[model samples]
Target: MRIAVLMTNTDESDFSNSWPKDGEKFPAMMRRVRPEWEYVVYSVKDGVFPEVLTGIEGVLITGSPHSVNSGDAWVERLFGLIREIYAAGIPMFGACFGHQAIAKALGGDVAANPKGWVFGLVEKRFADGRSLPLYASHSEQVTKMPKGAEVIASGPDCDVAGFVMGRGVMTTQYHPEMEPAFIAALVEHLADELPSDVTERARASLVKEADMQAMAERIALFIEGQSA
Candidate 1:
């Protein structure tokens, strides 16, 4: 499959080579999921070419520092593009900001959580255990489920963790692409902002350490199951 990974942030200072640290971490995860597939990385922060998506088999929209609800023209444009992609019935998987974008595009709401942030690997109870092994570290969660979206997974903080609309459009609020070591790096970076309790909770959820191969296998199964 020709999969395009979209990078939405323009913060050059965020990490080395102008890519988010998690973006760099995900390819290793992808290799284990579909070794034969070609995965290309694109920066919407640079600009998006709608033509690049024509023959693509799948699109995985990565998390961003920016919110989908931001009053940016580019955000609106990307949402429009995603709407087109979704309409074409191409498989799309969105994480974090990508999930928020999916929510916004589908006539849902995105706002700061009144409960504030939920940072760590939260114990999410799925309606069915189809969405196990979720890894997330974010403050805002989707409170209201979008129209025609399935609430596959949920937790105390967010009622919407996983959602599938139509045939192949799917999203997860969790970061299956992020592992413990990666989250450790993020934790260190956000030390001041992250509470001690949150960090401890994340560490408790660590299994298999930072084995990208295993995480990739789990993610691959999840994606393939979506196709089935």
Candidate 2:
């Protein structure tokens, strides 16, 4: 099986010294979860999309610093691609920015979170009512839900923390692929932009452990299960 990863982040947001780009990081993370599958990346922000969706059994779109409302041409183009992927009936998974993108493409709206940036250790509630603390990093969130979106997970600040759409489409607001070190470096990179109090709380929460492997496995199961 093969999965195409649509990388949306162009620059590393000044974290070059310590963290790898999303494209470089996703494959390594996914491979650890499902080593048998082939993973190919495309720079979607650079307007590179899969010319041929045929034979691409599954898909994963990574998070980005860019917002769904950025009005960048590439983001618009990706919205079209998301629809195509869903129509094509391929199992799809989205992370962070990718989650918001999917929502917007499907008729939802995104706006700046009034509660401000959500950075680290949020307890996300699934539709069934189970909750777990996961690393989080975003200022904006989904304000209005899209038509037909089944919200599977939510946060107090981010109502649509995770959801499942039509045709095996699964998405989450947090980065299942990000390591603790990567999150730390990201916090440092955007400290100047993020509010001081937000960073302080985020840093304090970082001392606690997050099960990166477990998150990876959950995502893997959603993708690999598509084969059956």
Candidate 3:
């Protein structure tokens, strides 16, 4: 089994390159999860997705600085690929922009987040108490779930933090792979792009290293379970 992570460059002209960019964060986190499947990074900016994703066991799309609603041609193309992957019965997991894209691809809407942006660690309620390692580094969130979606997580600020669609696809508004060091680096790197107040809170959350590890283990299980 193999997991292909669809990555688009965060520095795309329209978006802000705040959080470590797709290249840095996605690879490092995939290593930590150690999905039973070998992991491959398919860069959209480099024109690899349509070819690289072929024959892959499963797919994971990382968060991006760009918005799905931006109407970028690449985003539209990627959205089509996501639909194909879902129709093929392959499991797909999405984070941040990835999450938003998944939602939009499945007949949902993505917006600029009128409430501003959500940054730092948040306590997300898993109705089943199943959420692990809660962290986020985005300004946009999923307001309405995609058609026929079942929400798995929610919080005060965001109505939809995580959701499951069809049989094998899942998308989370929060960053399950985020660690203390990663979060620290992400916040420090994006101090300017992010709201001024959340910087301190983001740093404070990373202090709890154990929680981050526990969260990573949960995600690993979820990713591996797909192969099983």
Off by over 4 Å in 1: 14-23, 195-228
Error of 2 at 184 (Å): 1.4
In candidate 2, position 157 carries an lDDT of 84
Error of 1 at 134 (Å): 2.8
Misplaced by over 4 Å in model 3 are 12-28, 33-36, 52-54, 210-217, 223-228
| TM-score attained by model 1 | 0.83
User: lDDT ranking from best to worst?
Assistant: 2, 3, 1
With candidate 2 superimposed using the best TM-score fit, by how many Å does residue 77's alpha carbon deviate from the native?
A: 0.5
Q: How close is candidate 3 to the true structure, as a TM-score?
A: 0.83
Pick out the ten consecutive residues of candidate 3 with the lowest summed lDDT: 12-21
Question: lDDT score, residue 155, model 2?
Answer: 83
lDDT of 3: 0.71
lDDT of 2 by residue, 66-147 (tens): 8889898999999999989888888888888988888888788889999888997777778777676678888888877778
lDDT of each: 0.69, 0.82, 0.71
Question: lDDT tens string, model 1, 1-228?
Answer: 777777674545654343345446566568866878777777775676456467787777878768777778888888888888878777778888888888888778777767656665566566766435556766776766667888777764777877788666677776767667566666666666667777666656564343445435644554565532
Candidate 3 residue lDDT tens string, 1-228:
677878864565322443455655655666665634476777875566756446787677887677788777788888899888888877788877888999999888777667776777777777687545577767777777777898888864787888887556777787766656666666787789767777877777665542545555555566556421
lDDT of 3 at 53: 47
